[model samples]
Target chain A: MSGPAATEAAPAVERWTPLSRISVVAAVAIIAALAFGPLVLNPDWVDKLTTLFIYVILAVMWNALAGYGGLVSIGQPAFFGLGAYAAVRLADAGVNVYLSLVAAALLVGLAARPISAFMLRLKAGEFAIGMWVVAELAHLLVNLDGLVQGETGTSLIAMTAYGAESRRAAVYWLALAAMAVLVGVVFVLLRSRTGAAIQAIRDDEDAAAAVGVRVLATKRLIFILAAAGTAMAGALWLATAISFQPKTYFGVQWTAYMIFMVLVGGLGTFEGPLLGAVIFFTIEAWFGGSGVWYLVGLGATALLFSLFLPRGIWGAVESRFPLRLLPVGYRLRGAPKSL
Target chain B: MTSNDDGAILAASGIHKRFDALVVLDGVDFAMRADEAIGVVGPNGAGKTTFLSVLVGAHQPSSGRVRFRGDDVTRLPAAERCRLGLARTHQVPRAFGGMTVFENIFVAAANGGGFSRGEAYDRCIDAISLCSMMSVANRRAETLGLLDRKRLELARALATNPVVLLLDEIGGGLSDGEAGELVETIGELRRRRIAIVWIEHIVHILLQVAERLICMDAGKVIADGSPTAVMSDRAVIDAYFGEGAA
Candidate 1:
């Protein structure tokens, strides 16, 4: 039989808050260096660091949809490819490059409205797989037309129009800026009342809905927001490479990389995905073209970590020593008030 | 609390519900004054749970009108009903298993009652203290045992700040002392004048609390009156207490 309910003593009931002590300071310092590392590095390494920054933004978007919304999507490449295609098309049509990039991201968000209607019909595993199929089909459909030059793909002449050095530097800074904005947006969202609703629904949707949460609409909004961010990351990737192919832009490898980063870093918390992305990028840069063995190594590492530290590295660290790197959501116990 | 009985806080007329032609509530009609602590006593399959579900918008009556505070709310969704101050517990406490004990209550206060974070926290803490589940507030609902889970369930409903609270067997799984403590807490609620409709199999407990008692069977109320009179009514004695319940 269940005992009398456990009444908390005031101290134990006090809400947990993370302190930005040495650990957080160290992590942030490291991240800052990583983002700007391209500026201080040899010219050869600039493109790679910029790529890592894009990965940071992409991981955050994926984590937001899966970790926070409980909608684990394996088809984020759909948005990524859409963003690239939009940018390439706009640059082709003689539009200003920057405006095209922004429009490209927005278009992905808008398009997600209808896509979600169909995808949301499936739940959990089915939904995740459905998104993957959507991405693959999108890639196939887009490749069939000469719009993006089919399988041969098309060279993005904008980087040439802008020249090599400035283009490289611009892409690097833009990726950094995008990651920062995505992180900031996530922090703001986590702090809002809506964030609490999202977290609640993620934990127990039926209970959340019973308590007046609009589970479907809220999730749809997150879907669009996260997709838009991912699309922007994809667009930036294409610009950095100055090219796009159906296979490359919509590659399932990007999905694999995103999932690995999130799972390794910490799926739910802010800064975890960023940290994970940095770690994965480091691993990739060091061992990238050493063949498929590199990927196998990363997967093996993830399997061990997932088995041992299911919450991911940052999740474990956060529990032992709280660091309020991203302070969102309310802490209720310190003060007493009349309702 | 101010009495607002004339406002007809809850009304049900011809509330018919069926489960594939096995009629549950056969034209059940009932009404409650504001802050009235009414009791619903019934044997198994009597539609008492179904009746409460209709009141709380969890189920729709086949042909009936349900008005709350003189406003028609038969078609409103469950969340809207919760926002409008109608809340209920499950017969078997369906606490959110994945959420923390505190979070379960917080959702109801914030989403169900439209309370601000500070306001919702206060109400949630208050409800937790009343139900006495605060110690496990940080613990996942999945980890809670039967009695504590029931407390969590009560905490959730109470956090909604309902004007008309519908409880479905909160005392069912509890021990005598636990039930007695809950009764005392509920008695305090009664003094504060919150309208309550408690459905239970425990006759004496509701008799000790509710001013009026109802007995339902086959989806219809067979008896409704003061506790003592209804407890002794021929049909109630036969169906509920039988000859040995005297």
Candidate 2:
């Protein structure tokens, strides 16, 4: 035993294990299958998939902000509105509709930088409501402008040039790609040194500062990044419908759905949001058109998940199974030769 | 490493701290030499923890200058001060409840101490072992017992590789056996030549590790000298066991 132990140090287990490998393989297979969806699926299914992608993006971004960064925000729709408006205004100004979608995301992300300086001042519960107030203000401000027709709504005239089939495919593919990029960015980020600093701040701001984390700076960065992601989803959403309405973009319902998805899936884990988004999409697709009962059903499901599964479905599953598809923490194995 | 020529590692003069109308530390002047462990004791609300907070930059002094290695750092943030080799443990243990015990120390080593990845990993492991918390290093801090939490607090501070460490009430809730173990850990740190200023109510435990004792009362240091002498001082006994105890 001593000879083997001396010959090689205890096996250092990294975050990536055999289980993670399997999870990754499964995820890649699913993504590849989804990529071919528009080719085989009916137009209605493709449209539903696009909506699912948007929800997934929104849920993941919200989780990163509130669950990991400890900045609960109810104002995500503010950035979403900005992205939608930017996309519409840019397209109206004769920019390529697809290019405008990308530009809108960038602009909203840049805009969040300055807003963060003010918004991040509020803590926890106050921060959540403060964000909602900001969104309402943004909604009011956007209505004052005439280019957006003052809440009369506007369509993506540039995209009208494409055939219905082509437009649907473009929106589906872009939405899927955007979701993949956002998830990939968040996944890589949480596995980095900066991610560690951000999580430290989440645990205790004072303790994090004591350990040399630039608290304000880290919070600001996360806020802006999450805004960019939510904005991107909003922009893609505008492309999907080819119409821009301030009320829909800035509505509190958008944020409510994001919260519900993250809460019912898992608040902090990467897999939780994904799982939550899928479950939410399936339920909506099956019963969404049932109107009042659909809303009631969604509410009841969320309440049940919260009451019995506070960690959400993914969290509960993780606690029971101890599986991590996107592990971001370190794990050591085998005892050292001596203390 | 200090440029004071007198080998003073940390110096604070005319330190005053106030929260609204309440004055916690009143015109306190304190300094420490290299590798010296000073024990600070006081009656309840004597500003012992407040003074430690001031030294570590957790609480900015109302009016005073804190100099570390001859450079004025009164305006520097706590995080900056920690990175500059001034570190402290809280009176109430503050652990990152969501993270494992090792991650808490790792954050200190990598972020506060500015160690690289490999060095931070090694330092975290060493700190856990030093604190005799290797068995629970992988456990979440929230799940640890009180003694383990205190050990984690010390390990977190130690991982920062401070030249001067301020510890507040680290021995407050420990049993005799656990306190002895903690004392041995602190003794090893003392042998390593790290300057320490410990604020603890347990006089005997403080005396076992600290070379000198300073007693405070109502925001003033009434006595400062050798442990045995300070403990027997008229003013110190009066502050602790009442006016007639001396």
Candidate 3:
């Protein structure tokens, strides 16, 4: 049905911002520079950057889960550990290690479907703790496997066959590629119709349902994506570190780091978690030697950000600059601006 | 159960909704023809909102059936019902706080109406313009004042391209001038041939647009007729003011 014509011209909806356009160029340049990191950076720095990539993957996945989907899972380490184990089993069966990483991610993503069906029945707090229980259960189940070797851990022996320098460089490239691909996937998803539904679910579930958003289905999709993404990060971490201990892989500290990173960067914004990961990496690199004091400092910093900068650094920056580097929201042109 | 032989666009029969031991709606039956504008009014605790909830599939009736366009929709979820051309607004606006006003409407147009991106954009522009929300279309929904929030609520529902729209107290907490504007916009919706079931406390404003009126009390509809007739009904007057006052 036609609407009554307005006295003025109809407003046009614009998607891209000036900063969003510049961000595209900036992202390309950054990825290209990072691609050359192994060639110029020292071996130690190369390895550190690979580790940093793992952190980025984790933060981004967690942000998508809690920030967008409104599913605050504290049990992501379950999928992370499972991914590492899946890769280990694949490598043992003579699959190429690189191929095993991708396969591991896909397998974990599929596994999350049934789990999400059960988990989605729960509300906010119940879902969060339920995930932790699921993660603990996975840790126990993995411990039962002979290949896991009961806390002694197992090395990715296939990785040992390659020359040290070439292996490090190749692994670095793989980590970089995984991070880039996952981030791109999330970006594209957020720009789609499904992305709008996901954020709508986050804002208010009942209203979203009334507005015709398939809330459960959308939440399940995000849950699966997050599971697969986190698993990819875990598999990459396994390759870089060259070892997998169920205890360490399934440890709660991974979830803590994810929370810290996402909280410090920004919870809901696309660019927030990325910036959070960088800030987190810098802090870890600088003060990791402080041992126990470092842990205290990290906790203290996250608490301060939560209290004072509740929106995180990116939120503060956006409020001041009014720019969107990744504009998922619409902008109406030819409309009177709000005071 | 009431039969749908009258060619009603929407119908609900014998709807009984109970929360624990308390009954919010007791054997409530309602039917509306295509493009019919009905206004629901009742005193506090009269179950007006609860009946709307049951009709829109937000709250399932303990025992009853809901049908839309000759299809059984009692078992369908709210989203499914919305996609089937049934949409609703909450008494309190529930706009997506992080999104702009335009995005809120766009989402409904795209998802509820199942339109392509271009069509959804066109639908959004129509809904926004009809609701007189053009000036603040780019502002975040959370920043909107009460009147604009109500407008966003109506616009979002309109964007769904609904065959039937259920509004729960859309005029609540609005000044007389603000509500008058809403009445005009709603009148425009009626002209577009979209059936509306609006629940409001403002009787005169509702009377201006409602072709039929239903007054409910204590989980039962006490009056159902033309606006003037329902307003003059002894039971409706008694429902509004305590018993024996009429």
Ranking of candidates on lDDT, top first: 3, 2, 1
| Residue A225 C-alpha lDDT in model 2 | 87
Model 1 lDDT tens row, B1-246:
113324688888889988787788898888898867889997888899899888877788888878887788999877888888888888776776545677778878988889997788788888878887655766667788899988887788888888888888989977889989999988877776778899988867877789989889778889998988888889976776574556
Identify the candidate with maximal TM-score.
3
What are the clashing pairs of model 1?
A8-B135, A18-A322, A18-A324, B24-B219, B25-B219
Worst 10 residues of 2 chain A by lDDT: A330-339
Error of 2 at B129 (Å): 1.1
Candidate 2 has a TM-score of 0.94
Point out the higher-scoring one by DockQ: 1 or 3.
Answer: 3
lDDT of 3 at A338: 51
State candidate 2's DockQ: 0.45
lDDT, candidate 3, A1-339, per-residue tens: 123332265567788877789998899889989999989999999999999999999999999999988999999999999999999999999999889988999999999999998999999999999999999999999988898878988978888888999999998998999899999999899889889889899899999999999999999999999999999998888998888889999999898799899999998889999999999999988998998888888888889988999778998898777778887667777676552
lDDT of 3 at B67: 86
Any residue pairs clashing in model 2, and if so which? none
Mind giving the per-residue lDDT tens digits that candidate 2 earns over A1-339? 864563245334356989998988887788889999989999999999999999999999999998789898988999999998889888888898898998999999999988998988888898999999999998888888887777898877899899999999998999988888889898888877778777888889998998777799989988998999999998988888777889999998787788789889998778899888988888877887998887777778777877888769888887777687878776654433221
Model 2 error, position B114 (Å)? 1.2
Residue by residue across B51-83, what tens digits does model 3's lDDT show? 999988899999999989998899999999999
Model 1: per-residue Cα lDDT over A89-134, one tens digit each: 8888988786787789999999999998999878899999999999
What lDDT, from 0 to 1, does candidate 2 have? 0.86
The deviation in Å at residue B192 for candidate 1 is 3.4
